[model samples]
Target: MTETLARLNATYTEHVIEDFQKKRVPVEIPLCLKEDRIAYGHNLEISYPLKEVLDVSYRYEPGKIGFLYIHTIQGVRTFQINSDPAGFVEQFHQLDHL
Candidate 1:
Protein backbone atom coordinates (compact mmCIF):
# COMPACT_ATOMS: atom_id res chain seq x y z
CA MET A 1 0.00 0.00 0.00
CA THR A 2 1.17 3.48 -0.76
CA GLU A 3 1.59 5.97 2.05
CA THR A 4 -0.52 9.10 1.98
CA LEU A 5 1.62 12.19 1.76
CA ALA A 6 -1.10 14.80 1.93
CA ARG A 7 -4.83 15.25 2.14
CA LEU A 8 -7.11 18.02 0.98
CA ASN A 9 -10.77 18.68 0.35
CA ALA A 10 -12.10 19.18 -3.13
CA THR A 11 -15.50 19.73 -4.70
CA TYR A 12 -16.80 17.00 -6.95
CA THR A 13 -19.96 16.74 -9.01
CA GLU A 14 -22.06 13.77 -8.02
CA HIS A 15 -25.26 12.60 -9.64
CA VAL A 16 -28.19 11.97 -7.36
CA ILE A 17 -31.64 10.55 -7.81
CA GLU A 18 -34.30 12.54 -6.06
CA ASP A 19 -38.05 12.22 -6.47
CA PHE A 20 -37.51 10.14 -9.57
CA GLN A 21 -35.36 12.85 -11.07
CA LYS A 22 -31.65 12.85 -11.72
CA LYS A 23 -29.68 15.83 -10.55
CA ARG A 24 -26.10 16.92 -10.41
CA VAL A 25 -24.85 18.23 -7.11
CA PRO A 26 -21.48 19.49 -5.96
CA VAL A 27 -20.10 17.47 -3.10
CA GLU A 28 -17.03 17.90 -0.97
CA ILE A 29 -14.65 14.98 -1.06
CA PRO A 30 -11.22 14.12 0.19
CA LEU A 31 -8.32 14.40 -2.19
CA CYS A 32 -5.20 12.48 -1.27
CA LEU A 33 -1.65 12.34 -2.51
CA LYS A 34 0.23 9.10 -2.35
CA GLU A 35 3.63 7.89 -3.35
CA ASP A 36 2.67 7.45 -6.96
CA ARG A 37 -0.81 8.87 -7.44
CA ILE A 38 -3.36 11.49 -6.52
CA ALA A 39 -6.70 10.14 -5.38
CA TYR A 40 -10.06 11.91 -5.26
CA GLY A 41 -13.43 11.23 -3.65
CA HIS A 42 -14.23 9.97 -0.20
CA ASN A 43 -13.44 6.40 -1.12
CA LEU A 44 -10.65 7.37 -3.45
CA GLU A 45 -12.81 6.43 -6.40
CA ILE A 46 -10.70 8.33 -8.89
CA SER A 47 -6.95 8.54 -9.20
CA TYR A 48 -4.28 9.87 -11.51
CA PRO A 49 -0.80 8.48 -11.39
CA LEU A 50 2.18 10.79 -11.00
CA LYS A 51 3.49 9.71 -14.35
CA GLU A 52 0.27 10.84 -15.97
CA VAL A 53 0.18 14.22 -14.34
CA LEU A 54 1.47 16.93 -16.64
CA ASP A 55 1.03 19.89 -14.35
CA VAL A 56 -0.68 21.19 -11.23
CA SER A 57 -1.64 24.77 -10.50
CA TYR A 58 -3.95 26.95 -8.46
CA ARG A 59 -5.76 30.12 -9.48
CA TYR A 60 -7.65 32.50 -7.25
CA GLU A 61 -8.70 36.09 -6.65
CA PRO A 62 -7.71 37.98 -3.56
CA GLY A 63 -10.00 37.19 -0.62
CA LYS A 64 -11.84 34.52 -2.60
CA ILE A 65 -11.86 30.78 -3.16
CA GLY A 66 -9.38 29.21 -5.52
CA PHE A 67 -9.32 26.46 -8.11
CA LEU A 68 -6.83 23.62 -8.35
CA TYR A 69 -6.05 22.30 -11.77
CA ILE A 70 -4.47 18.90 -12.41
CA HIS A 71 -3.39 18.43 -15.96
CA THR A 72 -3.02 14.77 -16.83
CA ILE A 73 -2.65 12.68 -19.89
CA GLN A 74 -6.36 12.00 -19.94
CA GLY A 75 -7.31 15.65 -19.49
CA VAL A 76 -7.45 18.48 -17.04
CA ARG A 77 -9.37 17.87 -13.82
CA THR A 78 -10.31 20.81 -11.65
CA PHE A 79 -11.24 21.13 -8.01
CA GLN A 80 -12.62 24.03 -6.01
CA ILE A 81 -10.59 24.77 -2.90
CA ASN A 82 -10.93 27.31 -0.14
CA SER A 83 -7.22 28.09 0.16
CA ASP A 84 -4.03 28.19 -1.82
CA PRO A 85 -2.69 24.82 -3.02
CA ALA A 86 0.91 25.93 -3.27
CA GLY A 87 2.10 23.39 -0.75
CA PHE A 88 0.19 20.61 -2.41
CA VAL A 89 1.53 21.50 -5.83
CA GLU A 90 5.04 21.81 -4.48
CA GLN A 91 4.84 18.47 -2.73
CA PHE A 92 3.55 16.79 -5.86
CA HIS A 93 6.36 18.29 -7.91
CA GLN A 94 8.93 17.16 -5.40
CA LEU A 95 7.61 13.64 -5.46
CA ASP A 96 7.18 13.41 -9.20
CA HIS A 97 10.22 15.47 -10.08
CA LEU A 98 8.23 17.26 -12.77
Candidate 2:
Protein backbone atom coordinates (compact mmCIF):
# COMPACT_ATOMS: atom_id res chain seq x y z
CA MET A 1 0.00 0.00 0.00
CA THR A 2 1.33 3.42 -0.93
CA GLU A 3 0.95 5.87 1.93
CA THR A 4 0.74 9.59 1.52
CA LEU A 5 4.05 11.12 2.51
CA ALA A 6 3.15 14.76 2.08
CA ARG A 7 0.21 16.73 0.78
CA LEU A 8 0.10 20.33 -0.35
CA ASN A 9 -2.37 22.58 -2.06
CA ALA A 10 -0.90 23.62 -5.42
CA THR A 11 -1.91 25.54 -8.49
CA TYR A 12 -1.54 24.03 -11.94
CA THR A 13 -0.11 27.00 -13.78
CA GLU A 14 1.76 25.36 -16.60
CA HIS A 15 -1.17 24.03 -18.67
CA VAL A 16 -4.83 23.21 -18.65
CA ILE A 17 -7.45 21.12 -20.40
CA GLU A 18 -9.77 23.07 -22.60
CA ASP A 19 -12.29 22.16 -25.30
CA PHE A 20 -10.44 19.32 -27.08
CA GLN A 21 -7.11 20.99 -26.49
CA LYS A 22 -4.50 20.93 -23.77
CA LYS A 23 -4.10 24.50 -22.73
CA ARG A 24 -2.77 26.42 -19.78
CA VAL A 25 -5.24 26.94 -16.96
CA PRO A 26 -4.88 28.25 -13.47
CA VAL A 27 -6.48 25.93 -10.94
CA GLU A 28 -5.89 24.79 -7.41
CA ILE A 29 -5.62 21.12 -6.57
CA PRO A 30 -4.43 18.80 -3.85
CA LEU A 31 -0.90 17.58 -4.52
CA CYS A 32 0.37 14.49 -2.80
CA LEU A 33 3.68 12.67 -2.82
CA LYS A 34 3.09 9.10 -1.83
CA GLU A 35 5.31 6.11 -1.33
CA ASP A 36 5.04 4.96 -4.94
CA ARG A 37 3.71 7.98 -6.82
CA ILE A 38 3.08 11.70 -6.91
CA ALA A 39 -0.58 12.62 -7.41
CA TYR A 40 -2.47 15.83 -7.88
CA GLY A 41 -6.05 16.62 -8.74
CA HIS A 42 -9.39 17.98 -7.67
CA ASN A 43 -12.36 16.53 -9.58
CA LEU A 44 -9.86 14.73 -11.82
CA GLU A 45 -6.67 12.92 -10.85
CA ILE A 46 -3.17 12.46 -12.28
CA SER A 47 -0.40 10.37 -10.84
CA TYR A 48 3.25 9.84 -11.73
CA PRO A 49 5.10 6.78 -10.62
CA LEU A 50 8.17 7.45 -8.48
CA LYS A 51 10.27 5.21 -10.69
CA GLU A 52 9.62 7.52 -13.60
CA VAL A 53 10.49 10.69 -11.73
CA LEU A 54 13.89 11.51 -13.15
CA ASP A 55 14.63 14.50 -11.00
CA VAL A 56 13.20 16.99 -8.54
CA SER A 57 14.37 20.50 -7.93
CA TYR A 58 13.28 23.80 -6.44
CA ARG A 59 13.66 27.48 -7.17
CA TYR A 60 13.30 30.58 -5.03
CA GLU A 61 12.52 33.90 -6.57
CA PRO A 62 11.85 37.32 -5.04
CA GLY A 63 8.39 36.38 -3.82
CA LYS A 64 7.60 32.92 -5.06
CA ILE A 65 8.76 29.35 -4.40
CA GLY A 66 8.53 26.67 -7.04
CA PHE A 67 9.01 22.94 -7.33
CA LEU A 68 10.25 21.42 -10.55
CA TYR A 69 9.53 17.80 -11.33
CA ILE A 70 10.93 15.93 -14.31
CA HIS A 71 9.29 12.67 -15.16
CA THR A 72 9.71 10.21 -17.98
CA ILE A 73 6.08 9.93 -19.09
CA GLN A 74 4.72 13.17 -17.66
CA GLY A 75 7.55 15.30 -18.96
CA VAL A 76 8.51 18.34 -16.94
CA ARG A 77 6.04 20.17 -14.75
CA THR A 78 6.44 22.97 -12.28
CA PHE A 79 4.16 23.73 -9.37
CA GLN A 80 4.08 26.80 -7.16
CA ILE A 81 2.70 26.51 -3.70
CA ASN A 82 2.63 28.54 -0.49
CA SER A 83 4.44 26.05 1.63
CA ASP A 84 8.10 26.00 2.58
CA PRO A 85 10.18 24.97 -0.41
CA ALA A 86 12.94 23.55 1.75
CA GLY A 87 10.44 21.32 3.45
CA PHE A 88 9.31 20.03 0.11
CA VAL A 89 12.86 19.04 -0.77
CA GLU A 90 13.34 17.36 2.56
CA GLN A 91 10.10 15.44 2.15
CA PHE A 92 11.12 14.15 -1.23
CA HIS A 93 14.53 13.18 0.07
CA GLN A 94 12.84 11.12 2.74
CA LEU A 95 10.62 9.56 0.11
CA ASP A 96 13.75 8.43 -1.71
CA HIS A 97 14.46 6.08 1.16
CA LEU A 98 11.07 4.46 0.83
Candidate 3:
Protein backbone atom coordinates (compact mmCIF):
# COMPACT_ATOMS: atom_id res chain seq x y z
CA MET A 1 0.00 0.00 0.00
CA THR A 2 1.21 3.46 -0.77
CA GLU A 3 1.47 5.96 2.00
CA THR A 4 -1.01 8.82 2.03
CA LEU A 5 0.72 12.15 1.60
CA ALA A 6 -2.23 14.41 2.33
CA ARG A 7 -5.92 14.30 3.09
CA LEU A 8 -8.37 17.06 2.20
CA ASN A 9 -12.13 17.32 2.24
CA ALA A 10 -14.07 18.61 -0.72
CA THR A 11 -17.51 20.14 -0.42
CA TYR A 12 -20.43 19.05 -2.54
CA THR A 13 -24.05 20.01 -2.64
CA GLU A 14 -26.80 17.69 -1.47
CA HIS A 15 -30.53 18.22 -1.24
CA VAL A 16 -31.76 18.06 2.31
CA ILE A 17 -34.64 19.31 4.46
CA GLU A 18 -33.88 22.52 6.24
CA ASP A 19 -36.53 24.44 8.25
CA PHE A 20 -39.12 22.13 6.74
CA GLN A 21 -38.05 23.15 3.29
CA LYS A 22 -35.90 21.23 0.87
CA LYS A 23 -32.64 23.07 0.32
CA ARG A 24 -29.24 22.49 -1.07
CA VAL A 25 -26.62 22.00 1.59
CA PRO A 26 -22.91 21.56 1.41
CA VAL A 27 -21.53 18.14 2.27
CA GLU A 28 -17.97 17.22 2.99
CA ILE A 29 -16.23 14.40 1.17
CA PRO A 30 -12.84 12.86 1.70
CA LEU A 31 -10.01 13.35 -0.78
CA CYS A 32 -6.75 11.52 -0.23
CA LEU A 33 -3.50 12.12 -2.04
CA LYS A 34 -1.22 9.15 -2.39
CA GLU A 35 2.10 8.95 -4.11
CA ASP A 36 0.46 7.54 -7.21
CA ARG A 37 -3.11 8.77 -7.17
CA ILE A 38 -5.71 11.13 -5.79
CA ALA A 39 -8.77 9.40 -4.34
CA TYR A 40 -11.93 11.29 -3.56
CA GLY A 41 -15.55 10.72 -2.61
CA HIS A 42 -17.55 9.50 0.32
CA ASN A 43 -15.91 6.10 0.12
CA LEU A 44 -12.98 7.10 -2.07
CA GLU A 45 -14.72 5.60 -5.05
CA ILE A 46 -13.06 7.88 -7.62
CA SER A 47 -9.39 8.41 -8.26
CA TYR A 48 -6.93 9.80 -10.77
CA PRO A 49 -3.40 8.51 -10.94
CA LEU A 50 -0.44 10.87 -10.78
CA LYS A 51 0.64 9.76 -14.21
CA GLU A 52 -2.74 10.84 -15.51
CA VAL A 53 -2.71 14.19 -13.77
CA LEU A 54 -1.89 16.81 -16.34
CA ASP A 55 -2.04 19.81 -14.05
CA VAL A 56 -3.35 21.12 -10.71
CA SER A 57 -4.49 24.61 -9.80
CA TYR A 58 -6.36 26.53 -7.13
CA ARG A 59 -8.63 29.56 -7.42
CA TYR A 60 -9.35 31.68 -4.38
CA GLU A 61 -11.91 34.42 -3.96
CA PRO A 62 -11.74 37.37 -1.63
CA GLY A 63 -14.59 36.28 0.66
CA LYS A 64 -15.98 33.30 -1.15
CA ILE A 65 -14.85 29.67 -1.15
CA GLY A 66 -11.80 28.33 -2.90
CA PHE A 67 -11.68 25.82 -5.72
CA LEU A 68 -9.19 23.14 -6.66
CA TYR A 69 -8.88 21.89 -10.17
CA ILE A 70 -7.30 18.63 -11.20
CA HIS A 71 -6.59 18.31 -14.86
CA THR A 72 -6.30 14.63 -15.74
CA ILE A 73 -6.12 12.67 -18.93
CA GLN A 74 -9.75 11.77 -18.51
CA GLY A 75 -11.02 15.29 -17.85
CA VAL A 76 -10.87 18.29 -15.54
CA ARG A 77 -12.33 17.82 -12.08
CA THR A 78 -13.14 20.70 -9.79
CA PHE A 79 -13.57 20.58 -6.04
CA GLN A 80 -14.92 23.17 -3.65
CA ILE A 81 -12.49 23.53 -0.79
CA ASN A 82 -13.00 25.73 2.25
CA SER A 83 -9.37 26.04 3.29
CA ASP A 84 -6.27 27.23 1.52
CA PRO A 85 -5.19 24.79 -1.18
CA ALA A 86 -1.62 26.08 -1.24
CA GLY A 87 -0.44 23.29 1.04
CA PHE A 88 -2.17 20.61 -0.96
CA VAL A 89 -0.91 21.97 -4.24
CA GLU A 90 2.61 22.23 -2.85
CA GLN A 91 2.56 18.66 -1.69
CA PHE A 92 1.36 17.48 -5.05
CA HIS A 93 4.13 19.38 -6.79
CA GLN A 94 6.74 17.97 -4.44
CA LEU A 95 5.60 14.41 -5.00
CA ASP A 96 5.36 14.96 -8.73
CA HIS A 97 9.03 15.88 -8.77
CA LEU A 98 10.06 12.65 -7.06
Candidate 4:
Protein backbone atom coordinates (compact mmCIF):
# COMPACT_ATOMS: atom_id res chain seq x y z
CA MET A 1 0.00 0.00 0.00
CA THR A 2 1.27 3.45 -0.92
CA GLU A 3 0.51 6.55 1.12
CA THR A 4 2.00 9.99 0.59
CA LEU A 5 3.58 11.23 3.79
CA ALA A 6 4.89 14.56 2.54
CA ARG A 7 5.52 16.60 -0.58
CA LEU A 8 8.52 18.94 -0.62
CA ASN A 9 10.83 20.81 -2.95
CA ALA A 10 13.90 18.83 -3.98
CA THR A 11 17.15 19.45 -5.72
CA TYR A 12 18.54 16.63 -7.81
CA THR A 13 22.20 16.18 -6.99
CA GLU A 14 25.05 13.71 -6.99
CA HIS A 15 24.23 10.29 -8.49
CA VAL A 16 20.54 10.53 -9.26
CA ILE A 17 19.44 8.76 -12.43
CA GLU A 18 17.65 10.82 -15.06
CA ASP A 19 16.30 10.13 -18.51
CA PHE A 20 18.66 10.57 -21.49
CA GLN A 21 21.49 10.37 -18.91
CA LYS A 22 21.65 14.10 -18.34
CA LYS A 23 24.58 15.39 -16.27
CA ARG A 24 24.44 18.13 -13.67
CA VAL A 25 20.87 18.81 -14.60
CA PRO A 26 19.19 21.13 -12.15
CA VAL A 27 15.45 21.28 -11.82
CA GLU A 28 12.99 22.06 -9.06
CA ILE A 29 10.63 19.15 -8.57
CA PRO A 30 8.04 17.92 -6.13
CA LEU A 31 9.36 15.17 -3.86
CA CYS A 32 6.81 12.95 -2.23
CA LEU A 33 7.27 10.35 0.48
CA LYS A 34 5.00 7.37 0.00
CA GLU A 35 4.52 4.06 1.78
CA ASP A 36 6.28 2.13 -0.99
CA ARG A 37 8.43 4.69 -2.72
CA ILE A 38 9.67 8.26 -2.99
CA ALA A 39 8.53 10.06 -6.14
CA TYR A 40 10.47 12.88 -7.79
CA GLY A 41 11.00 14.91 -10.95
CA HIS A 42 8.67 16.73 -13.35
CA ASN A 43 8.37 15.17 -16.82
CA LEU A 44 10.66 12.31 -15.93
CA GLU A 45 9.43 10.82 -12.67
CA ILE A 46 11.85 8.79 -10.54
CA SER A 47 10.65 6.48 -7.85
CA TYR A 48 12.80 4.74 -5.25
CA PRO A 49 11.47 2.08 -2.97
CA LEU A 50 11.58 2.60 0.80
CA LYS A 51 13.34 -0.72 1.30
CA GLU A 52 16.07 0.43 -1.07
CA VAL A 53 16.83 3.45 1.11
CA LEU A 54 20.06 2.40 2.78
CA ASP A 55 20.76 5.63 4.62
CA VAL A 56 19.30 9.04 5.44
CA SER A 57 21.46 12.08 6.07
CA TYR A 58 20.60 15.66 7.01
CA ARG A 59 22.59 18.88 7.16
CA TYR A 60 21.35 22.16 8.62
CA GLU A 61 23.24 25.44 8.51
CA PRO A 62 22.07 28.67 10.07
CA GLY A 63 22.25 30.79 6.93
CA LYS A 64 22.18 28.10 4.26
CA ILE A 65 19.46 25.83 2.98
CA GLY A 66 19.05 22.52 4.77
CA PHE A 67 19.65 19.26 2.88
CA LEU A 68 18.27 15.79 3.10
CA TYR A 69 20.18 12.94 1.48
CA ILE A 70 18.52 9.67 0.76
CA HIS A 71 20.84 6.81 -0.14
CA THR A 72 18.89 4.37 -2.18
CA ILE A 73 19.36 1.75 -4.91
CA GLN A 74 20.05 4.43 -7.49
CA GLY A 75 22.56 6.15 -5.19
CA VAL A 76 22.39 9.34 -3.15
CA ARG A 77 19.67 11.82 -4.06
CA THR A 78 19.63 15.22 -2.37
CA PHE A 79 16.82 17.56 -1.40
CA GLN A 80 16.39 21.12 -0.16
CA ILE A 81 13.10 21.66 1.56
CA ASN A 82 11.49 23.85 4.24
CA SER A 83 10.52 20.88 6.37
CA ASP A 84 12.47 19.98 9.47
CA PRO A 85 15.16 17.34 8.90
CA ALA A 86 14.73 15.91 12.37
CA GLY A 87 11.01 15.44 11.85
CA PHE A 88 11.66 13.73 8.53
CA VAL A 89 14.26 11.48 10.10
CA GLU A 90 11.84 10.55 12.85
CA GLN A 91 9.13 9.64 10.40
CA PHE A 92 11.53 7.68 8.23
CA HIS A 93 12.80 5.71 11.18
CA GLN A 94 9.31 4.88 12.32
CA LEU A 95 8.28 3.70 8.89
CA ASP A 96 11.48 1.75 8.39
CA HIS A 97 11.11 -0.06 11.66
CA LEU A 98 7.49 -0.94 11.04
Best by lDDT: 3
Tens digits of per-residue lDDT, candidate 3, 5-97, equal 888878989999978999998899988888899999888888898999988899977568889999888899999988777777888988753
Q: Write the per-residue lDDT of candidate 1 for residues 15-83, one digit (tens) a residue.
A: 999999999998888888888899987799889988898888889675787899999988999899876
Instruction: Show where candidate 4 strays beyond 4 Å.
Output: 12-26
lDDT-best of 1 and 4 = 1
- Candidate 2: C-alpha lDDT: 0.69
Q: Considering lDDT, where higher is better, how would the candidates rank from best to worst? A: 3, 1, 4, 2
| TM-score of each prediction | 0.80, 0.66, 0.83, 0.65
Ranking by TM-score: 3, 1, 2, 4
Instruction: Kindly report which residue stretches of model 1 are placed more than 4 angstroms away from their true locations once superposed.
Output: 13-25
Best by TM-score: 3
User: All candidates' lDDT scores?
Assistant: 0.84, 0.69, 0.86, 0.71
How high is the lDDT of residue 70 in model 3? Answer: 93
Instruction: Summarize candidate 4's per-residue lDDT along 16-94 as a digit string, tens digits.
Output: 5678685665657777777777777783278877889877778877567788888877789778855556755666766
> Candidate 2: which pairs clash?
16-23
RMSD of 3: 2.6
Question: Worst 10-residue stretch by lDDT in candidate 3?
Answer: 89-98
**In candidate 2, which residue ranges exceed 4 Å CA deviation?**
13-25, 65-67, 71-74
